[model samples]
Target: MKAVLFANTDWYLYNFRRSLAMSLLRAGYDVLLISPDGPYGPRLRELGLRWEPLPMERRSLNVLRESALLLHLVRMLRREQPDVVHGFTIKCAVYGSLAAKMAGIPARINAVAGMGYVFTSDQLKARLLRPVVRGLLKLALGGEQGRLILQNSDDVKLFRQAALVEPAHIRLIRGSGVDCGKFAGNSPRKNREGATRILLASRMLWDKGIGEYIAALRLLRNRGYTVQAMLAGTPDPGNPAAIPEQTLREWVDEGTVTWLGHVDDMNALLASVDIVVLPSYREGLPRTLVEAAACALPLITTDVPGCREVVADGVDGLLVPVRSVEPLAQAMRQLLDDPALARRLGEAARTKARNYFDERIVIERTLGVYAELCGPGQEARQRRYG
Candidate 1:
């Protein structure tokens, strides 16, 4: 059997879906990855998997470019002719599924990582785009041969209410689960012991609560708390919410936070910090929180959909209101001042991660989905729907 994984960015395959590919290969299925060419493309090649480059634009709203992209994907799907095609992210899922259908592919799967900003508003664009996307999704997932996978219940409920997908076709999975064993608890990094270090690992986007995090940091500093802040991850230039490099540099210079831009060793970084913070306005399920929990670090995050799934309020971490600085500051201060409380929370978090978000579980479940789609069941599905 053969499977093709389609994504908008090469980084998505590299960072998150590599395990799934490896699992497929181990299960004796040929795996092919299709994404825009990048530095990570060669790495995928080195993994003995087939790699195809597509000209995908991540944040463009250009109709002509997107149509061209759809044409390219359709051609690729016809040529490669994989048994099953799985699409990730928003645009990829929309376009890839449509192309796979056009090519008469037997199995199609769409993984909705997050609802994203497009579905978060009541603007004319949102109103217009939602129906268009929903129409495309309905066409792609309407048949018995396709499945729609979501990361959180909130997204599942929202899309169901919107009538974007049939309830029977939708399946739920945890945010690409983390490797608890790999990110297991470790002693804090040897450092200036007197200070508290808080780390926020996410893209530099306004909706990610970068502004709120900075404001909370300033508030904590003003209150004379011995604190240090770190921000990691790259900025998406095409994304409207991206923070300017100059502003980020200014924050670093002002000593408000340490900017460790795009560190590969996230587990080590999480180990070094006293607290893991993600004040994101929303999430599909932030992998950073799962990694931190695997490392047995306590969390401070917003009371948003994806964030809430990871942190159990006061049990393993604290939840503050989305986009609010005061609540964030208060939560951070409470953890910083109360060492015993932080330690207890961290232990609780590690325990929870082991029980729920093990990476092996995610890989197994994902492979099961692939198997169901490509196995003998496909014949029955086609007979029923075709």
Candidate 2:
């Protein structure tokens, strides 16, 4: 069998789904990666996987351009003729599913990581596009040959409530998965120097609660706390909620937070930090928190959909109200002042990571999704539906 995985950026395919691709290859299935060209494309190729660049603009709204891109995908799919086509994220999922159907592909899988900007943002453009995107999702996501994968229960509920896809077709997979072996370690890095280091590693987007994190840190500083806060990851220009480069620079200049832009070595970075936090307004299950969990680091994240999935309040991590700076600061202070509590939470988090978010478990489940469409059961499904 041949599997084609598509995402908006090569970086996503490289960092997030490389293990899945390798697993498919080991299983004797041909795998081809599709994404917008980037530096990571060569890195993916270096891994002995086949990769093809597609003309995809993540934030583009031009109807002509989008139509042309759809045509291009259809043509490519016709030529490649893969047994299964799996698309990740919003745009890729919609377009890949439509193109796959147009090209008469046998199996289609669309992974909606999150509702994304259209549902998350309150801007006028986003507000207007919400209904239109929903319509497109409803149309493109249907059919016996297709399966829709949602990361969290909230998303599954939302999609079911909206009737975007058949309830029976929706699959709940937590995340892309983390390599627990790579992240888990016996010797976690300790801050020998004073000051509790709190790290939030994710794309620097306002929707991610970056502003709130900074404000909370400021509040901590005002209260005479020696907490060192670090922001790892760069601004995503393609995202509507992306923080401006100047804004990040100003924050760094003001010493509100240390900006470690685009960290390549997350394990090393996680080791150095004392606590991990991602106050994202929402997520499809942020990998940063999972990695932190594997590293046995205490976590602080908002009580939102994907964030809550990785944390149980007062169990594995601290949960704060969304977009509230004071409550966020209180959580940070509680963790900072209580070393025993932090250690206890960190231990529980690692246990959760090993049990749920490990890569092997996720990869196997994803392959099982493919099996629903490509395995011998597919023939029976076709006969029953026909």
Candidate 3:
């Protein structure tokens, strides 16, 4: 068996889908990864998978360039002739499905992870681009050989309402799952001051509520609150919504919070933080929150779709209004002031991780999706549908 996974970035394959790719290999499928070559591409090679760097622009405005990308992918897919092709994010899903279809690949999978800024931003440009994006998505996912996978029910409804997918073609598999055992609780990092430690681990994107986090920290600092706050993760230069480096440097200079850029030891960092928070405006089940929960860290997030799925109001974490600085500060203060409640929430979060967000469960479910589309099943499906 042969499979190809297409994504926008090499980091995505390494960080998010390594487990799934490794599973494909174990199940006896030769895996080929297609993405823009980056530092992480070599890491994927180290894992024994063939790598092909596609010239995919994450935020491109040129239609000619994108069409060229599609043509290139089609030629590659036609040459490789894989049995199954999986694409992540909007561009990859759209272009990958088109390329695979043109190449006569038998099965295709497209993952809609959060719908991106095209749906989230309220700017005029985004509004104008919606119809075009919708049209492109319809073309990408509207086919017998493809299945559209979403992380949250909200996104599922959005696509269904847009008539982008049929009920039979839609699948709901929550965020790329996290390892429960590896992230089990460890003592949080403490300094001599014995202050509560809070961390936000995600790309430094405005939509991820990075600015709101800094504002909340400033508010806490003004109130003379002695809590330690850290922002872990680096800005994604490819993403248009990424916080400007200058702004990040300004925040660092202000000294309201510490910025730990790209902490490689995620488990250790989570173990060391008393609380984890993500004030994202929206998400397709943010992996940062799930990983933080798996590490037994109490969560503080907005009361939005993907976030609400993981937190039960006051049960496993506190839910605050989106984009509000005061409420965010209050929620963090609540967790910091009440150690007992924090512990209860942390424990509940771990239980939730085991029940719903285990990496193994997600991998199995994804493999099952792949299985239904490939091998003898592929022949049967083709005969039945063709």
Top-scoring candidate (TM-score): 2
Which segments of candidate 1 are over 4 A away from where they belong?
Answer: 121-128, 188-192
Tens-digit per-residue lDDT, 1-386, candidate 1: 88899987788898898888888898888889999888888888898877888887777789899889988988988988788889997777888888988888858888888877566544576677777777777677666777888888898898788777788878888888777888765744434466788999998887899999999999988988868789998788756567899999999999899999999988778878889999987789899988898887889999888888889898999999988999999999888778778888888888888887787887877777877777766778766665
Per-residue lDDT, model 2, residue 41, is: 94
Ranking of all candidate structures by their lDDT, best first: 2, 3, 1
> What ranges in model 3 sit over 4 Å off?
185-193, 384-386
Among all candidates shown, the one with the greatest lDDT:
2
Q: TM-scores, in order shown?
A: 0.95, 0.98, 0.96
Q: Per-residue error at 306 for model 2, in Å?
A: 0.4
> Backbone clashes per model, in order?
0, 0, 1
The true-versus-predicted C-alpha distance at residue 318 of model 2, in Å, is: 0.4
lDDT of 2 by residue, 337-362 (tens): 88889989999999999999999999
Residue range 69-174, candidate 3, lDDT tens digits: 9899999998898888899998888889888878888588988789788888887878898999899888878767788889988888888888997778898998
Question: Which clashing pairs does model 2 show?
Answer: none
Candidates 1 and 3 compared: the better one by TM-score is 3
User: Arrange candidates by TM-score, highest first: which order?
Assistant: 2, 3, 1
